[model samples]
Target: MACLSKSSTFSKTFGLRNLLNLTHLLKIIHRMFYK
Candidate 1:
């Protein structure tokens, strides 16, 4: 049970990190196109 909870927390953080990275990538793309 403890392992399952730990994995869930890790997945949540990993998902959040991926979302941040995607936002950063989109900003870069927008800048490149606008510039």
Candidate 2:
């Protein structure tokens, strides 16, 4: 039970990090296109 909770928490954090990285990538693409 404890391990399951820990893995869930880790997955959530990893997902958030991926989202943030994707957002940053999109922003860079937008800027390149605008320029």
Candidate 3:
């Protein structure tokens, strides 16, 4: 049970980090196209 909870937390953080990176990538692409 403890291990499952830990894995879930890890996955959640990993997902959030990926989302942040994706947004950052999108912003860079937008700037490249606009500028």
TM-score of 2: 0.94
* Per-residue alpha-carbon lDDT of candidate 2 for residues 1-35, written as tens digits (9 for 90 to 100): 99999999999999999999999999999999999
Error of 3 at 11 (Å): 0.3
Error of 2 at 18 (Å): 0.5
Reference-based TM-score of each model: 0.98, 0.94, 0.96
Between prediction 1 and prediction 2, the one with superior TM-score is 1
Query: Across residues 1-35, which tens digit of lDDT does each residue of candidate 3 receive?
Result: 99999999999999999999999999999999999
After superposition on all CA atoms, what RMSD does each candidate show versus the true structure? 0.3, 0.4, 0.3
Local distance difference test scores for all models: 1.00, 1.00, 1.00
Sort the candidates on TM-score, descending order.
1, 3, 2
Q: Report the Cα lDDT for candidate 2.
A: 1.00
lDDT of each residue in 6-31, candidate 1, tens digit only:
99999999999999999999999999
Error of 1 at 11 (Å): 0.2
Error of 3 at 13 (Å): 0.4
Query: Candidate 1: lDDT of 28?
Result: 100
Off by over 4 Å in 2: none
